[model samples]
Target: MPFIPTLTLKDRLPRPFKIRWLRELMDLVDELYFEYGIVHQDIAGRNLFISDTTGSILLCDFAFSAQIGTVRHGQSVYLGEIPRCNDVKGTMFFLYYLITRDPQYSRYLLSDVDENTIMDRPKWVKHAGVELDYDVDTFYNELMAWVRKRRDSPKLAHYTLAPRHFEIPDPPEDGMEGWYLGRSHTMREMEAGRTTLSWERPPASKWDKSRKLLATGKYADERPPVRLMHVPDPKKGFPQMGMTNAALRGQDKRKQTQDVVGTEDEAEASKRRREEADE
Candidate 1:
């Protein structure tokens, strides 16, 4: 998908914005909840974006999103029990924050906070700096009606099956073993060289970090000698050296080894060596 430049709603806060934009956001929430049968577990200022070109509200960040009625063991966030209410409640708190700029209600854990706490408030005092196209009542009334519609139509909200369902395909074989569930491979098979394997996108695990150790039976510790660009002053005499020429000569041969272990710098190696000596 082509990337479209957009700014988050939070970035544009305390500035005047159209009330219709927020209503559009509520429309998006309605579609995701009822039509798509997906629950965007996170609906907040940061996750909401206003298009730079189109001036429309765009909901992003599906990292915490899941299909409605999906329950899995070890999953921290699930929308199974309350299939359709998660996004609605989140939209309520988000709208509250947008108008009043009061984030105190949002800080509470989703499980602990009740949407009614905001809905039940007699009035929402808009911040002095904040501006909206329509009166606050217009927005609140529409939200109240949206919440009521969802609450009253429990049957529509609690549909066991979605209109559309998708299945995730199995991961293609990586040449380590045969295609079978939980099939175990020997250490030799697991480490089979990747030069023979064809991959669309190779895994970083296939890069051999310990190639020098495995081939030479000893790790490379020496770094390439630093060559000074300027000649030393004759008056001050030359600095003391520790096998500078031999270090320079072997530099070319150890280039490959250095390439593999370049991430470990000299300072870190010295610190590690000092720690080992102390031990």
Candidate 2:
């Protein structure tokens, strides 16, 4: 619930306290994802907070929770097809334009949580040959190391995310490909507060040009003071402002097709996901 606009804190802190606070909050998040099998897709600035008292940081933003095994096109599929993280924009992560599979990685890589009924694991993983009592701390350390190595990485940098004490990502086998399940189709949740909620879009929803608002006969026209512009005003406000049921009904369809066609941005995200999976 803490909005970033109202607060400011040090992104760079001393290693000792930073590591302590990070690890503590990480334990809670790891448990939630692995034990409960819930994926917190929003893992960056908007969803993070530091406690003034304990100097602890916690992850928030439940907007992207989804069930295990649910599949959508081009969404990042971490291990066992569990969601990793969502692209901050249409199909990319923040800072780096990558499709991520956060839930899958958190669930399987962390200690104790397993899809294997051997505690709850997939047969494929068992076939890959893993052992019990895996120390997740090592895994976390490695990931952190990777993040450090590629400090300025945009995406695909997660591949070497850190120096792993042990490898959690299974070796990729021939003909074994992974895919992501994008947002749920026809789900009203995907449509609500879309333009407004996004932080990546400059000026955000305030910029009427960013979104081509189909004017509803019943709706009044009142543009905000200043906003980011996404689309060119060919016909300007009056003509661009019209809306119809047909225009809205096929939103999911449009999105799916867009994923298939893949703009330069989407292509970049796909490339990042592929590299992560390959590594």
Pick by lDDT: which candidate is best?
A: 1
lDDT of 2 by residue, 1-279 (tens): 544432322243222324444445455544543455444554544445566555666566565554334433234654322323422211112111111223343222223232222211121131112222333343335334443433343332232332321223332344535643345534555477453332243343455664454433111354557976675333221111223345434444434344344465655665566566556
Deviation in angstroms for 102 in model 2? Answer: 21
For candidate 1, write residues 81-169 as lDDT tens digits.
35333777888888888888775864655556777668765648887877888888888888889888876865443324656545434
Residue 93 of candidate 2: its Cα lDDT?
23
lDDT of each: 0.64, 0.37
lDDT of 2 at 15: 26
Clashing pairs in 1: none
After best superposition, candidate 2 residue 189: deviation in angstroms? 17
Q: Assess the local accuracy of residue 84 in candidate 2 as a C-alpha lDDT between 0 and 100.
A: 33
lDDT of 2 at 161: 31
TM-scores for every candidate against the unseen true structure: 0.55, 0.28
Best by TM-score: 1
List the RMSD of every prediction in angstroms.
Answer: 15.8, 28.1
